[model samples]
Target: MTTRSSPLPARLKSLLLLSCFLGGIGLMHAENWPRFRGPSGQGLSTEKRLPLHWSATSNVVWKVAIPGEGWSSPIVWGKRVFVTTVTDQSTRCRVLCLDRDSGELIWDRTVFEIVPLRKESKNSYATPTPVTDGKRVYAVFGDGSMAALDFKGGVVWTNREISFYSRHGLGASPVLHDGLLIMPFDGSNRVLKAGIWPNTSDEERLGWQIPWDKAFIVAVDARTGRRIWTASRGKSRIAHVTPNIHGTGRKAELISPAGDVIQGFDLRTGERLWTAYSQGEGVTPSFAMGEGLVFTASGFEKTTIRTLRLGGRGDVTSTHVAWEQRRGVPSQPSLLYLAPHLHSVTDGGVAHCYQAASGEVIYAERVGGNYSASPVAGAGHIYFLSENGETVVIRQGAEFSVVARNAIQEKTQASMAVSNGRLFIRTAGNLYCIGSKH
Candidate 1:
């Protein structure tokens, strides 16, 4: 006795579903350069036909003057771009939002009024790159402050949790996993709870034992700024290596490098799973992982490049280590892998190529200029950015061949960001967008 309603025709339903699926594919094509090295944190963008050759005068879509000092790179999301800058002699930490299409400065908000601490000559207050997840942007500074701002530049939350900052300042940026913000606080010199540094007019610090255990990796709620998990690096020396995921899929392991050790931990619980051997006191470079091997370069002293086999429990010091490259390793710039070979440009501009699995030296050649910005690879070419504004683009293969020697002729320390077939470079003087009518 009930009236029956007929379903839509099968062909019509299929057509409607196909329409929605294609719409989603269109949205996915709208990419966002989210983190330090784009989406994968490897400086490899899926964006094809990126502008290969660019100068201050050529392919310049828009150039805007940035009014501050920072080493953080620009991150783009949809139609907006985000970057952080610390001005007023490193006292003001600011978050800048710009139009991605026109490079117009839409909003600039000061996140914190910081008292800049003793930092290395090269490290600025706003060295850690801000990360965005379309809803909000996150920034961290040298003065031990991290702030989350909404997409429209409203301050959502701020945390000054670890005041014991080291001398080299904050450089490792926060990474987003699921619903949390992962930040690593690794400093060489630790400040006491009373804010007294080792030699900062406080002779009392000379007699007191400086806590080398102050360094740690922490995760906070992305929306609330509340601590979710923390793992202590009490046995670790100071390091600034940013944490990255190791495994594939939704459940991946987190790996963080310390002074003399690289530890793997559970991302959800922060429980230590394994620790690998990496020698040196200041482990600055982050790890590059793929194909069952995790590659890392130790800090200045010794500078040993290690390739460890991933997926193990407990101590992986000897069991998981695959190979080690002892010479011409980098301390500041991270490693890049292009198929069967791994590439690295040392801080002194020495370019190296090694076998990905065996660590066999393929070729060693010197490019030019002292390098701090990590090399980025694109369009079958590897880009090595130097501190003096020169970028050497080389062919990516077993043999080393320089493609072009391009420059903006301005000092810059940030790595280039590629998005939507355009290259965004932040220098000491200006922010430039490079494109070729794409």
Candidate 2:
């Protein structure tokens, strides 16, 4: 006798399809590091089995010498790794793609070229990291030139609407959200007869020490590179902060910070939603949001860690600030808020942990290195990379307990990227992939 089987119920079939769709999403998240600090623009990785111990030779799956100079971090999408560099005497801004597993150059394309502007000694002509949406890679050069390229190294489009000029150059990387590419050009005045280095006089320090009104934030369509909208920051000093998105859906806001101010804008229209006054110039650290609170460091002058409550319209400086702590403020590295505790490391290498809710200090200990790269967390540990190529790993908690210290003994300024259980560290001249070969 032949037996017949009944088909699944309609509701059961719907549920099965949803499960497969969500599983595909989770797999995508585990395999890609598509932007500056990973998929979120905040240095947090979900990949497990990341290498905890690596050196110049040990635990290194592959190492390739990159051409030219760029402090921009490497970004990964699937089997490809992307990074930007400026070669030919800082006149040619180029993008390079490499094989993620084999460390071989897949393609190299020059996005644009320009007469490089005078930047800070530590800054580079290609300091802004590129962002990828799995199909195309978007990069912004120091001169405010932006371009989008396909996976095969063909240029799709380029935009040069803004001629960017910053005493510190372009350090803020562009961020991609909901088919829009957002970038901030918080720069100084175009003409300053006092030259590159400002003097003590306020006249000579027009844009460096004092704020200017030329600063603006822009958003462009990711696919066509067409200008969508531009929001003006009336008067603000130069900054190198990459913006991050907060909340979701219609209520979503872009949290962007420049010197002397931090503001939120509607993600779709670039409408200024709120503003908070922060002091000092040349701000570099980006915002860290969690538990409906935003954490950022005040740049230069008197540095401090300021925490603000989310949601408030117009100037919320007086109404939304929850607390301000002047200790352990980082001038370069971005703040890392890991659940109940907020973690920060100063440029001088002193690490501090604080209660995220009350802003109370839990512990402050010296880690011993000058840091330029921001801290990243994964596999139950926080990795802080220093300018001198030392990584101090500490367990995630209120206590100041260090897990391990790994060193490659090379000069490193770019933040590390984690993907598929490997750490991509960009030193001065080479990119090292750290993971077990097995």
Candidate 3:
């Protein structure tokens, strides 16, 4: 009798990995953290059972030490999780992929070499979160270098056609839609000349911000990195808001918040469709889309929440603006748009709930500790990640009630990612996966 040996262990493992990469292992159409915030480009996810409480020791799935510094949140697709970090002491922009099941380092690929720019004490060189559409991942750095990589860390393309340097470094993450990679280039030469960005005592004269004339939104082919179109923001100041893809069918629009003005771009051709005067500078909060309205927090100065009607042309500041509220608007954290109520947490730790359409303040409560991460909602609860790595879970409703306080006791600035009932938190030194069973 002839006996046949089973396939080798290594070959079986490889085949299994390939199958998972091709959407095996019960991985359906749902994406975990494919983009900056999560699927739908909002902080909210459809995850039903994220961990309610977890300390550094409790409910700890795995903790992996990350090299260098990065404020970008971890993104996931199928069985893999990808995060961008600066290696070689912030001199190289690199992408690290980890196996979602075991937290094993699958691969590490350095995309580009970048000189350190004068960033704020809180900002990092690898601040922009990498986004993926399952088959490939896209990572961009503050130096305006971008690259595309396959599932196995093979580099597919690199595009350096757009060069950018911000005095506060780059915080605007790229968004993908309609086969285009959209990036916001907002920096201030005035701030660079004044040496105003936090007084970093770099001996290399670390501040270099070009004039506002060069600041605009650029669209490149997501698969090929080919330039598609460029739209000038026109005298807009520095902003860090990410674009929100809203509307449906032929009326789809890319609503982006530019400092001093907010505008909508055509998703297909990068055409300037509509414009509004946001009347602010350093706008950081990403625009929230819901109920045919676009809501935004006009950054540090002239801070307020502006809600505008979806479709408008030219200057729609007065014509299409539904309401403007100045109550507990956050400068850094974006709001959670859950139909009737818009939830938000300020950098100073005050949480507020507002009526979505009319801009009416429902309730304002102080949850404590500074927050830079935006609010993400799942399983009928909203989560707010503070700068000190304290995740305050609150029941979402008309009245704000604290559900639980989970403290990890680490420094975290990146927003949290939720998917498949798991919460991914990225701190200054490590990446922790909660709700994972070892």
Candidate 4:
């Protein structure tokens, strides 16, 4: 006769359920700040208890000096931190990996070397931030050179098919989706002479001021670095805006913005799906998307915040535009969309909060300092890092309220990264990991 097993004890069952419930909480808070603007690529963080007040000395878990020069922000994966820099007079491109906990250097490897391209004094040769898939780190330099390195500093693959040229240099980072690494080459055909600020005439600024058909977005196989497809922007000028994916699965769209055009492309096949004319050149701020709407800043010329409703075909300039705001559009920093509220700080130090659905300005105030690093949100606080390395922290609400103003008193241009309840800040000379000591 077969014997029947006894049921688990009531106490044991209760213990098991409680253990699972706690495990769920741990998983929820264990998100990585993987890319340029964290995992979402839109400067949003879900981890709580992030450091609210940190200076050069206080609350700093660890600090280390980074070699070379780069404006590329630190990207975190698991226990490793990855960042790229160009040394040897911006010719030697190097990628550095550090331990996430104690801020120790794990490995530093030079991926490749290239002749330095012309860039603005404020921009670096390694301006584009690196992206990782938890397996390998992918980086792109100013000359359209891409490299992938494994966690152990092993070079995986490199691609240098496109000869990228831009008057202001490349600043847009690559995004990884479905085993493909996609990057936009919205560069101009003309390269400005060294130390030249303004062009002599309109004829000398064909690619920068006038639209060109050679600008394209290319996708490569993540594993092999083989070209997957190239999507042309038709006729568009230069822009530094990075592309973000909208939706998921087969219906997803790659939302790409150039100087004068914001277009949607089929993520899988690289086909242009829709377009919206945004007149401007040298567009820097990456767009933000939420609630079935895409928000972008029309760069340079007539700087304005334009919101477009999703799901449109061909030219959606007139049909899909939901609202437009002209008061406080940021030219450098990207937009932060937090539910019903949108937050942005202009390069001139003016911060504004707006209603996400209506384009109504809730508050317009000056927090101080010139801002280039994009603002990051966590623990219901928005942290806006300025060029002078001062972070103006504000609470997320209808009324503009300052929470804390923290300063490291250094030169900083790269955006901040958050992960595991800690903030990774990259200044001109050092990388600081900020967290509570307790």
TM-score winner: 4
List residue ranges in candidate 3 displaced over 4 A: 1-31, 190-211, 436-438
Per-residue lDDT for 98 in model 4?
96
Alpha-carbon TM-score of each model against the true structure: 0.90, 0.92, 0.88, 0.94
Who wins the lDDT comparison?
4
lDDT of 1 by residue, 301-391 (tens): 6679988988889888989999998876888988898788899989989999998999999999989898888878777888888898888
Tens-digit lDDT string for candidate 4 (147-259): 99999999999998877887788999999999999999998766435634445666347568889888999999999999999999999988999899999999998999999
Q: Give lDDT per model, in order.
A: 0.82, 0.90, 0.83, 0.91
Off by over 4 Å in 1: 1-30, 192-195, 199-211, 248-250
Candidate 4: which stretches are off by over 4 Å? 1-9, 12-29, 191-203
Q: What TM value does model 1 have?
A: 0.90
Candidates 1 and 2 compared: the better one by lDDT is 2
Angstrom error at residue 57, model 3: 0.7
lDDT of 3 by residue, 1-438 (tens): 999988779988998889888865334443478988898888878865678989998998889998888999899998898999998879988999998867899999998997677777888888888899888999989778999999999999999887676757788899888778888887665233434443444422221221155577888898899888998776667778888788666787788887778888887777888788766777888878888888888866778899998778988988998899998888889888998899889889999999998989999999999999988988889999999999999998999999999999999999988766688899999999898582
Model 3 C-alpha RMSD to native: 8.0
Q: Could you tell me which residue pairs clash in candidate 2?
A: none
